[model samples]
Target: MKKPKILVVIEYIGENGNSTAYYWSQIIKKLNINYHVVLISPENKESLKFSKLYNVDSRLVKVGEHNKNSLISRLLGQIKQTKAFIYEIKKEVNNCQLVFTGTNPIVTMVFLSFFKKIKKFKWLVLVHDIFPNNLVPAGFIKKGSLLYKILNYFSFLLYSSPDRLISIGRDMTLLLEEKIKKGNVVFIPNWASTDKNKPENKNKNEIILNLGWEDYIVFQFFGNMGRLQGLPNLMKAIKSVNNEKARFLFIGSGSEASYIKTIIKEINIECNYEKAFFYGYLDLNKNNMGLNACDVSFVSLAEKMYGLGVPSKAYFSMAVGKPLLYIGDENSELDILLSEYDIGWKCKPGYSDKLALLIDNITDEYICSSMNKNPRKLLIDNFSEDIILGRIEDVVISTI
Candidate 1:
């Protein structure tokens, strides 16, 4: 029997590396199904490599050039991209059995939700981030602004129309339940590929030896350095610690990279110990080596960001068997995992003093060693690639 084909639309696959690409690759490889990817133009080499590796067909839509400096240019680019995406999807979707997507390219979700052609197929929306709601708290727009009101209404309409909505956390599902039918949503947390293990001997790792991190308890914050990460508060917490034993590392870049750099510079001027380091971004292959170099992982979210999106890096930290030190909403999904699994610690957002205290408390060698074992076990039990994707397969089979 022939396998069913599903059309998956995401904004961009691979200039650098993305969790979305990693995610779909696993599903395509393991599931007995075919996938067609619709992406925006200026496709990168990494995306091509990913397509070849996964045996999935990719179709690119030419949305004009993106100009980051100009708001008008950005709006025009999205307009073109949305139109192209809608046209291409309309042409190809009729042959597919289901349509699967997320809310990344907000324009695509806005147009695709209402497109008549899509209503014929089973539609599944993976809610990675809740918009307008997130934007308002982030200060991107006023809560009562016309743009906010318009997008909020569209979000309600779009979310309500989907046959199945897959949310990344329990809080997100609860938030959606207010706007969407309870039965239409399913909670499937984001997962990481568990192909790598924690290094047996950190002393033998070349990267750690080169960085001279072997002597310190490395606390790494990897992935995007965006505003929602609450990184400024983390830097403040690190400065207040006055500890020689802990070294904080920031990886990756985004809107807040420059601000993080500025804070680091300010802290260095006033302090004798080089308490923090910024290494920018690493390639996909080096991710394991980087994670292994650290003793513990740091994850943060602004208090307002709760229920808007889950910081996916926490899953990667667990996959690599490193305990996480999370700074965000207490009793959140991450907080619950840390508490129940005995794997890590959590503090309220912006509480650098409390964060420092937590770090100090975990410095005992026995405590660290004991905590390390639980992360990978947690991954195997709940967040492993096989387990999560298997759930996705069940959903697909049932939907079809």
Candidate 2:
């Protein structure tokens, strides 16, 4: 049987890139078994490694060096990067039978949607983050404004262009239903980065031992401390917590890092709970230690954050058999998971009182004895890389 060629256009895919790069690498690895896969991206060592390991044909795009000091300079640089990628994709897209991509550099994808109308190749889009609409929650743009309507019309076009639209969150699939036909969307949740089927022993973690947090019930929030995470609400919840033995640990750094630290300082003084600490970004491989060190993993989304995106860290937290303490929209994906599996607790983003009450009641003894025996089973059964990629492969092959 002749294998159909698939050209994957993405912005990043290497050690330099974030977790999404590793995710696509896994997806490509699975696709390589039955398809002729070609990749187009700016050069990275991991991409080169994939070229050798999976027999994927690599096409490199030039990424412009951008000045980060000003918003205008950064926007210009992104335009240059997008132009370079479009040129590279155009050069190779004709040779491939299918084009596979996610919504990074979404502007390029929007432009590519127009090209899809003229070309015969099948297009598949894996929706990670919904745009313009997502921006509305962050106060980036007004929902019904001229700019929002214009970008949303193009987003509709982009959604309609794909032969198959892969949605990571069920809420996202529902949201896309408004833009395109329901038959075109497929729901597949993102998987854990770790392959482990069981929890790592906290006693074995050097970081936990050195920090003297062995006696406390640790709640860890590790990832981008970004605007959309509802971090201010988390600070409010932390301030309301009265449990002296309930420690909070932050493992990643971003825009709200300093703000979170300032709030932690206030909490330490006002509440006299000196257990909270902000440990700046650690290397990728070291994330396992941080995950293992915590009794519960904290994941939060800002108000009006439904269907915009699903955080990948929640799955990583599940992989380590840790219960999740989620704060986000009601009936969001995390809420659904919590309801189905008894995996953890959920509070609405703005309700710091509810989150605080939930936090104060969770004890080490209760977590160890009363909680689900194996939270990692969720990943093992449903969200593992192999399971997710299998679903994706079926979609691709069945469509072909």
Candidate 3:
């Protein structure tokens, strides 16, 4: 018998070497069901390569450039692309057995709200980032404003229409339960690519040598350097640290990249020691090597961002057997996991003094080495691809 088809819709499919695309590609390849992928992205070499490697029927709806600096441009681009996407997928929508998508592109949510009402396919909504709720904390929108009320209602309608709402963290699941039906919400934490991200020696890694970090205890933050990461606090913490044996690396690009550079320049004038280096975005293929070069990984979130979104980079740090230095909410899902597993350290946002102290304390050779061992074991036991995907398979089968 032929396998049932699943339609997976996403904003960008491995475009410009996106890591989420790489991670999802692994999951899509392993899925037993036949699947078709629809990407709302500019037609590019990376997208074509992604489709070929995944060996799936893929279609791309051309969209304008994604400009992070211009909110109006971003929205207009999505609106234009979404219309094309809806038209392209109209014929395939009714033929598929299920539709899987995440809360991205804004357009995807808009599409789901309409598609769920007409199609008989089981709608699986992956809540990667909560909408208007997350925006209120980030100061993008006022809570009681007319725009907020409108967006909130739309978000509620979108989320409630799904057959199953898959959340990335326990805190997210609870929040979803408040908006969505309790029975529809499910918690499935993101997984790491353990097989792809093995531990590597810092001395032998080319990326480390290139950055002149061969002798230092590196604290690296690799991924989107956006407002929600609380990067200003991290930069301040690194500047305050007097330890010559330690170095900080910021890799990746976003709206905050220019701000990070400005901060680094100010630190350079006052601090004699070359403490921090900012390396803008690296491709997905080189991300593993970049991650392996670090002695410890840093993951941060703004205080107000707690429970709204979880940093997926935490899993990559663990997969590579590197301990984390997290600066975010003390009660967040990542904070609890780090404390429970004894794999990393956590400090509250904007507490640069406390973060500096934590960095200074972990300089001991024995302490750092011991903490590194726990992450790999933790990855295998809880966050491995096979383990998480097995649960996902169960969810998919149950939906059918």
Top model by lDDT, which number? Answer: 2
RMSD of each: 2.8, 2.2, 2.3
Per-residue CA lDDT of candidate 3, range 121-198, in tens? 688877877887888766788989999989888888878888898888877887788776557887888888787888
* Model 1: per-residue Cα lDDT at residue 108: 77
Over 27-76, each residue of candidate 2 has an lDDT whose tens digit, in order, gives 88788887888888876666777677667778877676766434468567
lDDT for each residue of candidate 1 in 48-99, tens digit (9 for 90 to 100): 7766665567776555678743546766777777777777687778877777
Q: Name the regions of candidate 3 deviating beyond 4 angstroms.
A: 32-42, 364-373
Ranking by lDDT: 2, 3, 1
Best by TM-score: 2
TM-score per candidate: 0.90, 0.93, 0.92
Q: How far does residue 173 in candidate 2 sit from its true spot (Å)?
A: 0.5
> On TM-score, who's better, 1 or 3?
3
Please estimate how well model 3 matches the true structure, expressed as its whole-model Cα lDDT.
0.77
- Cα misplacement distance, residue 114 of candidate 1 (Å): 1.2
- Ranked by TM-score from best down, the candidates are 2, 3, 1
Q: How many pairs of residues collide in each model?
A: 0, 0, 0
